[model samples]
Target chain A: MPSSEEVFEKVQAALMDALGVDDDEVTPEATMVGDLGAESIDFLDIVFKLEKAFGINIPREELFPDDILTNSSYVKDGTVTADGISELKARLPWADLSKFEKNPRVQNFGNLLTVNDLCRYVESKL
Target chain B: MRWFWIDRFEEFVVGKQATALKNVTYSEEPIDDYLPGRPHYPHSLIIEGMAQTGGILIAQMQDFHPKVVLAKIGKAEFNSIVVPGDQLRMTAKLMSLQSDGAIIEGHVTVNHQPLAEMELAFGILDDSFGDTSFFLPGGFFRILRSLRLFEVARHEDGSPIQIPDYMLEAVRQEAAQ
Candidate 1:
């Protein structure tokens, strides 16, 4: 199994290649969409690169829980409900959802994924 | 005025790699018109040629089921200018293939010299994009036939890649019409 640092490096490289961002810009705290300027399509490219780098199969839902976020049962108005937050916490144990929990707007969810979260996810898989 | 950038498929391996050739000639309108006096092929068209080469390779993997579109050009680097009379050979290798998208690494060469390199991303559109078909049935197949894609294409097991029945049926329907 790769160490946490190694996993972070591989994830960083994947993000850099996928988003055309520099190494320093891919700091652990950087938000994928906010800091790296990743679009929705870029995630597919990132997933492909990460899979290749770590020799792991990343199911789309594990990284992007679009279904959960979009489902009416989990969302009220534009925000994710308390149950939705619980589901997100369960689905994305690797991600830090504390900050997002305060607002939990479905739109805000896209920008919540950080580089550190990605590394943790990769480490979880390993 | 066909949008075809590639002249012919020189090599094709299903779901793997493809190589196509484009012979530039001064007779082409773009050569003289693009740069006024200097008659070199536009880099944009070179990228288009690579996209076509790579796009078709990705499409064939799914028997052209998914509406494959070039979503991004991750990287494009031109080492030398291509002039008329230059025979450009473009090879695209499938680097990654997934349900939502794919990536291909492409290289363009002229006379055994590296001319350009590209990394392209292709997206497979789902039904949300609308149920309309992008091409008239059998239209793309006719172009593929003209390019001799079936003649050169082969599966990994070395078996010949046959034209999909739907495409053939479309051809027959068009012929009957």
Candidate 2:
């Protein structure tokens, strides 16, 4: 399988193909529905991308149902906040420990992480 | 929503089938941010729609308890991108099950044109360490039904299909003394 970064890039490319969007569009900040006008079909494409990229199962619950809710700040481990910013912090000083983590739309989609997020974790391990 | 509604189980007793519809609306919040007139429906939502179909049935299988988390997705194929205003008709059928997980086959079609579809295996996990959380009033099931979205149908003949005997056996978790 490709490295985590490679997998993310693959997902990015696949989503681009599925959405007919430019490569620059799929940033971490972009919500699948909110930022990309992605309906259910495009999302399914992303899952296919993620599954192929990472070699794992992404069940329905793996990806949060509502677009807005998936992007919003969530309480992780029932304590720490897991918005994107905090997500960056959580990775550096150890991936998780009460400090909330970004719940990747990454159910068993392999590694329980998004491309960039997985990259960060991989980097942290070094 | 992403999953397209096709039909509902009106005749089936144990097994049920349902359909969802996903219209790629131009006015969705995301389009405004994109440059020009580019628009498309996100893919994950489609699966959720299918999952909702499967999820609801799983809930029905489990008597709507111990919420079924999508345990696994197998062999998903994207025939094409689903766009706004495109009528996507989705269908889900009970495949198989075990004490730990279930397999359901679902597909997505737009104007009868196949777009994306997959055969999914979902697991009913305990509330601990799982995404398939039970009692999610705001979850997919409520949203789809309350909104009166999806054409709820159980079988191909506009009738409910009998629940697969094995699924009934697997779903019976309480164990009789």
Docking quality (DockQ) of candidate 2: 0.03
Best by TM-score: 1
Q: What is the lDDT of residue B162 in candidate 2?
A: 42
Q: Can you write out model 1's per-residue Cα lDDT over A72-99, one digit (the tens) per residue?
A: 9999999999999999999999999999
> Worst lDDT window (10 residues) for model 1 chain B?
B131-140
**What local lDDT does model 1 show for residue A40?**
71
Tens-place lDDT per residue, model 2, B1-177, is 333333333222235455555555676654444444656665666776677677666666554555676755654788676666777666777765444466678877777888776877676665455655444433434443443533343444556434334434543532442
> For candidate 2, lDDT tens digit of each residue in A1-126?
456566557667766765667878877445455456665434555555555555665554424323223343543333333464344343233223221234333231122233344334333333
| Clash statistics: count for each candidate | 0, 43
Judged by DockQ cut-offs, the docking class of candidate 1 is: medium
Interface RMSD of candidate 1, in Å, is 1.2
Worst 10 residues of 1 chain A by lDDT: A40-49
